[model samples]
Target: MTKEQIIFLHIPKTAGTTLREIVYAQYAVDRITPIYRDERFMDMETFSQLPPEKKDAADIFIGHFAYGFHQHLSGNRPYKYATMLRHPIARGLSLYNHLKNLQFAGSEISFSELLKNKGSQFRNNQSRYIAGWGTQKMLETAIQNIEKDFLFVGITERFNESLLLASHDLGWQLKPYKRRNVTSTMWATNYADQLRNDKESMQELQKLNTIDMQLYEYANKRFSQQIASHFPNAVEKLLHFENRLHQAA
Candidate 1:
């Protein structure tokens, strides 16, 4: 049987960098196409124009794009999609900190201010990315896509279990690796302290991402069902993976 091509829809601030490393390690360098944040190949116009041979040679496509890319690509091969979702509030905070770290041109704006900005992309970003639209239909379409099309949907809070389930489905022998692009624990602790001290701001941020919060809850429930239905020994295997990961650390 021909192996299905893997399409990883890497949502931001969801431990995607670490997962990308694990997935990439399983494939030969020449057999994978990493779209990542590369501007040249990010848009559909450029991605669709890749030489047919390059598309044919690649077995895995990892990227930050939304769901529709699979339909646009030129190929008859079957594709299996997977993605991880983060709690909307947590994701928003992480994104805020990441942008702050980069000293973005408008780095001085408060997280709440940024959320209120009309042009801000970070608000309800997960829902927007998954649905590819800004209307109520986007949330409906995103839930349907996840339920009907994705082979697996995972939650960042349950990272080990998610990886174990993905490995089981893909028939890969995955091992834990050191995390990449992580926010430091010290900074995270400080941020958490600030949030605790400012409940109003935190609440506002949560209110702003209502769509993402709903989507995340839906994804989390489906993730649990997927683990239950598909990976019977998921808990056991996840425990083993976590133990090994700790020892390596």
Candidate 2:
């Protein structure tokens, strides 16, 4: 197993759940950190204060934590951060739909109310996680952090390619995965189509995610560059991986 501690900053609703399961197969149970699910987040400050030996036991830390969360860990081993970004508007809509589902039945969130909630996680959330916090210069900081500190930044839209690319980058033995945590069910609302039909609602969602949009665009560009520079036969390998997944299915 690699000595480097891999920190997965799982931005909500970005196919992180599916990727998380794939990664779990790559490590021993004890080597992986406890992953808090749904809404109860791990107390970062409490976890950060754990003794070095205690913290050093795990080789991989996985969570819905922010980008710089690795800073909280003991400085005993090398750290490599990774995350997945999605098209900001789509991601936001997904989050909105998810929260609406969580509420008491019939208490649906109107598009206007979702847009106006200043504390909504869907609002510039990808940038907040990437920059590790909100700030005036968040985009610049997030870009620099990605280039300088992160081992990989995967795109949720291009999940298969991103997984293969990340496996290659991070020394992982590849696995075929059936996608999990999908909203491919009768209950999940088709909010993207709804947003497209309503101009004002769409514009409001767009406005809320401007920084996240920029960050996602940059991640996509970097993803292309990284693949070209690192995986010359990526297309063939990706095709082969897809064939395996198809066969497995």
Cα error, residue 56 of model 2, in Å, equals 0.9
lDDT of 2: 0.79
Candidate topping lDDT: 2
Stretches of model 1 off by over 4 angstroms after superposition: 39-45, 105-107, 116-119, 134-136, 186-196
List model 2 lDDT by residue over 5-91, tens digit each. 888888888988887887888888778785565445455666777889978888888887877677677787899888899999778
lDDT of 1 by residue, 1-249 (tens): 128777878888888988888877778878877785566445546667887776777787888887776776666777877788999878767776666556454456666665566324567878877776544677788888877767777788888877777776666675868778776452433353455467787887777788888899888887788788886877787788889999999
Indicate the TM-score of model 1: 0.86
Q: lDDT values of the candidates?
A: 0.74, 0.79
Candidate 1: give the clashing pairs: none
Model 2: colliding residue pairs: none
